[model samples]
Structure formats: C-alpha cells, structure tokens
Target: MELLCLLLYVTVNLACIEGYKWTRQNLPVLMDQNTQLLEQSLFREQVENMNVGQFEKLCGIECQTSLPPLNQSEQERILGYETMYDNGTRTHTDVRLRGLNTTESTSYVSSLTRTKRQVFGADGRFVISDLKFITNYPFATAVRLSTGCSGVLVSSKHVLTAAHCIHDGRYYLESVKYLKVGVLHLKSKRGKRRRQRAVSKINQQNMKKRPVFRWIRVKQTRIPQGWIHSKNSTTSLAADYDYALLELKRGVKQKKFMDIGVAPRTFQPARIHFSGYDDDKSLEGTQGGEKVVYRFCSVAKESKDLMYQHCDAQPGAAGAGVYVRLREDGGKGRWRRRVIGVFSGHRWVEVGGGEQRDFNVAVRITPAKYAQICHWIHKDPTQCKTV
Candidate 1:
C-alpha cells in the first residue's frame, strides 16, 4: 500500500511538470502567430507591391514620366541627391547612387550651385555645406558585434554588445576583447586650429566637445555561456536575445558623455544615422582590429517595434547605433543628440544552395531599452531620470 501511494504521487507530479513546460513553450508561439496574422491583414488593407506605372499614376507624376523632363535637375535634388554648390548668385549640384560606380551619375555638384541662382532669389542663402555630402555620423560610443549581434550602454559603468560576440558555449567562444567609444573625425578639428586657439584663449574654455575623442575601458563582460543550447542552435532562434552589457572600469569624462536618449511617446518623423567598423572590408583572419566607419540613413517614421532603416551596409558594421539629431532653438549652440536603434545586421538563410539576402534589421531602443540600460548603470531605480 505504501509503495502504491508513492507511485501515484510521482505520476501526478510528472504530469504537472509536463503541462507547465508545454504552456511555457506554446504560449509565445500562439501569440506571435496571432500578431503576424493581424499585421498581414492590416498591410493588405492599406497597400501592396505595385509596378512602376501604377506608382507614377497614383503619385500624379504620370505626365512627367515619359521623357527626361527639363526639370530633371530640380526633381533629383528634392529626392535627396547631393547638392553641390549654391552660392546666392549661383547654383551647382551632383547626384549619384551609393555603392555603384557609374560615370553618368557623377555629375558635378558645382553645376547645381550655378542652377540654384535661376531657381531662387538673389538674397537666397545656400543652406547646405560641403560636408553635407557625407552621411550623418551616428553612435555616441562605438561597439564591436558578431554577425547579427548588437548591444547598448545601459549603465555608465557597463557597455553592452551582443552575447554572441563573446560566447557561443558549445561551438565557439565569440572572442571579443575591449570596446572603444567617443571617437570623432581626426581631421575635423585640425582644419579649424587657428580660430579654435583664439576662441579658447579669449574665453578660457576647454573645447573638448569640438569633435575630439574620449576612450573607455571595458573592465568585465557579463554573459551566460550555456544560453546557446545545442537543440536550439540550428534554428539560431536563441540569438534573438543575443545581447550583453559590459562593466567599464571607469566612466568617460562628463563633457564627452553621450547619454542614451529616451524614446518619444509617439515617435517623431526623423532620419537616423549609424557608423561602425565592418569586418567584411577588414583584412582577412584579423578579428576586427582595424577601424572602418560607414554611415547610412533610415526610413522615416517606420512602425516596427524594432526601428528599421534602408541603409545597405556590410557585415563588419554590426553593433552600430541608429540615432536621430535633435535640433531646437533654431539650431543654436544648444544642440543635442539621441540614439533610436541598433544595427542588428542581416538575417539570412541558405536557400537554393546559396545564401539569399533579407532586410537589414536593427534593435529598436524603446523606453524599455533605455530603462534596462540605465538600471545596469546605477543599479538603483531612484537614480534613473523619468525621461
């Protein structure tokens, strides 16, 4: 009778354990499927892929489409083509596709400056500058990430990178070392040396904020090696949470500090920028020891929980920050910046005996993203600013 009672108790406990596991595993799958179905229905109701002719008719540019209109110059500039020269008296410009080498598209921007005189009034000012041709710089501090890996600085004491950047547990140790931050163009300041010295001497001000750099030391890394389990390894699903935050030995100088910005309640329509050292262009076999920075812009007012951008970048530029520039008070000296997303890298799969391309995804830094990072920084809820 005693043995029979023990057996019954064990059977009941096993059943309960199996039920709990089933619930834990299937709950998220059901929720995600439901969400996907809803999104698809919404997308179908709003819009779908259409051919070129349909787009032109819908946009009311059909009459202007048949031939290269004389107004081609004006149209291109409005489409974010690089504006070359715009003297109040003259106008010149250039427009070209990125990453493509074609002489036809490489028209001089100076010519556009000459054309602007006819387009605008004599007193009209040239708002754009030469440096504007380059893409906007992003990231307060640079980080290294594995392919599709990314991280954030939640704590002043900790710098985050992808968990896969450090450890793969069963297969590999992601082999990441130190991370550097607060770098600016080495040439940006040297060009203005004369005026900078005079201004510093007159005001007795330290202008470290003049696009110089400050470096931080990554003291320790925090990640669980066992997270990449074998059963889940083939699917690569575990990498969805492929994040890690590091504990820095000390904080960078306050002047050079780049605060992680809070996400807006209703996201503003703003362009984003990102920069990173990509390994694809780096010398083979060396582990991202060289620096390679590239910048790209994101789609305006996107809806994904993860902030998505259209910039085409190579593999090495992972872990780059997607940031938006904040302009206020008519763009005075009181300028500030904030980060909105992270370059999560391309999500790819082997198809037809070769790898097929997919969209370049980045980690959206929402309010939760900022809070988690801030918590890691102070480890005290009271210290985090409500923003």
Candidate 2:
C-alpha cells in the first residue's frame, strides 16, 4: 500500500508537470467590437473530426475518461466531451493537434467608466420578479443549481452555467455529488379544487408562503479543464473557461429552453438580459417572490472571454444565462432571444503591472465556444450543425 501511494503521488505530479498550456491557435479567435462577426454552426463531420482546444480537455489525459454509450445504465463520467471520450478512468486514443503559428495573447482591458448607475436593490429597478409568469417561455427555463447558483436551460436536457458553480479550480464541489436542478413548480388543479371546498380555518391564504420548485436529478456535467486553476495555471487564462454544461437525467417537456448563439459585444441589440434566483435579501417577502430576479443593462467593457457590464447582481446570480433580443439567421427577420454569455457575478483581474481590478463580468460565447456547446447540446454533429 505504501508503494502504491508513492506511485500515485508521482503520477499526479507528472500530469501536473505536463500541465496544460494555452496556445493562440487553441484559443478562440480574437475580434474587436467593430469587426463583422461571422455566426457559427458546426457540422457533425467538422466537430467530430476536428481537434479540441487546450482548456477544453476537461477530462484530458490526466483524468483518463472517454465517450460514454448514450444508453449505458450507470453514470461514470461527469466532466468530459461525450463525443471525444469514453466513460471511466483508462488510457485512450490521442489526436495530433495542428501546429501553432500565431503570436497573439489574451488581453484584459479594464473598464471603470459607467454608462449608467448600477441597478440593484429592492426599490423597483431591474431587480424585479413576476411569479405568475414563471411558467412562460424563457422564465420557465430558469433553474437553481441546488448549490446556490443559477443556470438557464439551453436545451431539452442541458443547463449552461458557470464552471465555478460545480467545480473549483482543482476538483468538483462537494455539492455537485448530489446536484439537483430546481424548476418553478406548476400549479395543480386538484389542489385548487380542494381550496374551494375548504371548511377548516386553515385556508389557502393561511397556508405557508414560499417559492415552490420541482427538483430534477443531474446525470453528468462537462467543463473545460482550462477552467481548472492547475498548479501551474494562471487565473486570467482559467477565466476563459468559466462556462460549463450540466446534463439532466431527463428533459423538461412542459417548457422550451433558450438556444445558444455567438453574440459579440457590439451586437445590434446592445441591451443584455438575464434572470437568476438572486439571494439578495429583500423587504417584499410576499408569495412566490424573489425566487427569480431579472435584470438587463448595456455592455460596458469586454475582453476575448470576459465582458464587464453594469448589470447589478449578487453572488447567487452568478451562472445565469446572458442573452439578447435579435433576429434569427434566416427567419424572415423574425425576432428571437438567444443566450450569448454566462453571468460570472464579480471577478478580480490584473489590469496592469502589479495592479488588480475587479468588475461584474460574463463569459462571452465565441464561435469556437459556440461549436463546443453545440456539440454538447445536440450530441450529434449533424443536429448541432447551426447555432
């Protein structure tokens, strides 16, 4: 047992020694706000045969996992690409990466100037709720991560959220082992009928008043290892992989989820919107209130992966889906709402030589990032061809 322990320590160290590094080629293509953004929709042949990125190797060689059979009974994988790897710990096939030829680096430009005052608090600004409409299209898709974080349903069986919600830089969170998603509970007709026939003094209005939810089990989770602050990793680089996907045991049939898309900072509909189960204490503790708070604001500043904004939010609001109102690709210019980023709440960064600054930011969804998320959502390259 002593010898085995020693070998295991050395093995993990070796993996750290080969600690992953980000190459410009493996990172998302950098574009300025003034540039014309080319929307991405990856084909099956392209994604399956294409090479993965540096941070994208969540269960890379170190974890030794693989593609799980879709119909497999037991769940053995949690943070890997279902298409590229298999389930369990084992040595797997390796794909050769294309040579790097760029000298570009990820830049972090700070934005302290404000377009408007940060809107938060319970004074009827942006931090508002509509419990009666929780069963609507987009609001119905909002969910609680059980671990105090918020997430938006991006597909029938997947929830897109911040990686930090489920995993720290080193390992998965203790809460993730029993992760459950809480959906707004639907009203029952039988219960309504009982209330009408109530004779006891304990009436419907006298009953307990609290937000109700229908919890669901999570089957697996996936995140880019880049999000992991490895022993030799840098925080700025790790921030690029903040977004992740959570696969639920079953799909929600009553509600429709929002679709994922690549929306640059300068997208026409400049206003950004999202909703979350904010924990900020409020004075109005009325029936079915405060469970889901909605907010929207203009983009203040943005880097390749991060976008600093004036949107007011609290700790519990992190991981909420950031979206916008825009027209579809070719739907006769029909307006549509799509997710473009994941609200990261507050984050600190190095602005210059030994100077650190903090900002309320979200992870931007670039073309490459969109492609990866698409693969995870549809699983088939064919079905996930377009964003």
The whole-model lDDT of each prediction reads: 0.36, 0.55
Which window of ten consecutive residues has the lowest lDDT sum in model 2?
A: 70-79
How well does each candidate superpose onto the true structure, as a TM-score?
Answer: 0.43, 0.64
lDDT of 2: 0.55
* lDDT of candidate 2 over 167-242, digit per residue (tens): 6545555566677888876553335655568746555545544346778888777675346445543332255567
Clashing residue pairs, candidate 2?
44-381, 66-85, 66-86, 67-85, 67-86
Give the Cα error of residue 270 in candidate 2, in Å. Answer: 0.4
Off by over 4 Å in 1: 1-140, 143-157, 169-174, 177-217, 223-240, 264-268, 280-292, 300-304, 327-335, 348-357
Against the true structure, whose TM-score is highest? 2
lDDT for each residue of candidate 1 in 61-149, tens digit (9 for 90 to 100): 12112223213333223212111111111111223112221221111110000000111112111111112211122233554433233
